[model samples]
Target: MAKKKTTQDPALAQNRKARFNYAIEDTLEAGVVLTGTEIKSVRAGQITIGDGFVTINGGQAILTNVHIAPYENGNQFNVDPLRNRVLLLHKKQIVRLAVEAKEAGVTIVPLKVYLKHGFAKVLLGIGRGKKQYDKRQSIKKRDQERDLNRRFKN
Candidate 1:
């Protein structure tokens, strides 16, 4: 069989743990406000979003704890690697997310970061944290799928 091809670009950073730990209710795309050096680093795939999350403070969306490595040659222009960056989301979206996030065990997390139309964008997911038992169930389901795949292949 021929290999499949996709037009979408690979994500610069992804929070792989987010999907496993949270039961995502909704997902939306939002633009990221990055400085010159930060954008460069992102394009070069020097970012980590595993520990990053979104917060609505002062009616603005902020991306916190994401690390964009400094551009090698951007000496004076490079800012803090882990500085909080703003997310360019509409007022209505911000209000919705803020309200949802306030519910017990619900939160906003950065699911992925990718470049679109030459601009950096984040895939934010509004999710509720999963309990330990739910995680075990997820693992079991995944294992069953893998085993079934192997049996069919053989």
Candidate 2:
């Protein structure tokens, strides 16, 4: 008998600017609570996490500002595109993340959203905002690396 092959869905959305704007320290995978229409929209690759952020309230984590466009056929079942969604995380993890986020200039940001085993998951990053000089340094470093790679490839 031959084994069957399975292909996974690609990432629905990603916050590429997160790394450029912040220095990421830690990361965690989390599940998101979504309505049927929202999930459908997400599966259709109509989500954006560019300005999304995570916050802990009452020992639970919530995702805000992540936009999931209304489903075309959802009609009245479609909810707000920018509504807050709950993030499912362990209690201990929630406490730890909350504490880390409360530290000076630290925050929890959504790095990306993807499907895992047919369920939606979020990649959360604990990061600190980078200063202007830091951003400049990173840009310089990236340029130098690119130049080195080009020289070696030629």
Candidate 3:
């Protein structure tokens, strides 16, 4: 009797530029409330979070600018791709995020979207926009690391 092994699902979509443009101080995982067609599109890897941001309003966390492409076979069931979607989070967590987001230069950015236990989840980052000079420093550090790795390989 061998034990079964469960495979982890990779992110359906990611915001690659979030780290480059923002200095993330904290991160949170949140469940997404998606309709049937939207979920199908997400599971098919037809989702994008490049420009997504999270905002709290009326005690609810909303995901905006994330796009879940319409399912090919969904037809009428497919809803608007850019519609604001609710994020499932505890009231206390929402309150904390909202408070943190109100700080000057601080905002919530969507980092990644993945599926776990048949539910879609988003990884959100609490970050501040990086200054132009800071971005240059990040690039310099990355280039130095790449050069070091190349030197070691050859």
TM-score on alpha carbons, each prediction: 0.94, 0.94, 0.96
Per-residue lDDT tens digits for candidate 1, residues 1-154, read 9987665578988898999999999999999999999999999999999999998899999999999999999999999999999999999999999989899999899999998878999999999999999999999999999999999999
Whole-model lDDT, model 2: 0.94
TM-score of 1: 0.94
The TM-score between candidate 2 and the true structure equals 0.94
Which clashing pairs does model 3 show? none
Mind giving the per-residue lDDT tens digits that candidate 2 earns over 1-154? 9977655457788899999999999999999999999999999999999999999999899999999999999999999999999999999999999899889999899998999888999999999999999999999999999999999999
Alpha carbon lDDT of each predicted model: 0.94, 0.94, 0.95
Model 2 RMSD in angstroms: 1.8
Model 3, CA-based lDDT? 0.95
**How high is the lDDT of residue 147 in model 3?**
100
Clash-forming residue pairs, model 2: none
**Would you list the rank order by lDDT, best first?**
3, 2, 1
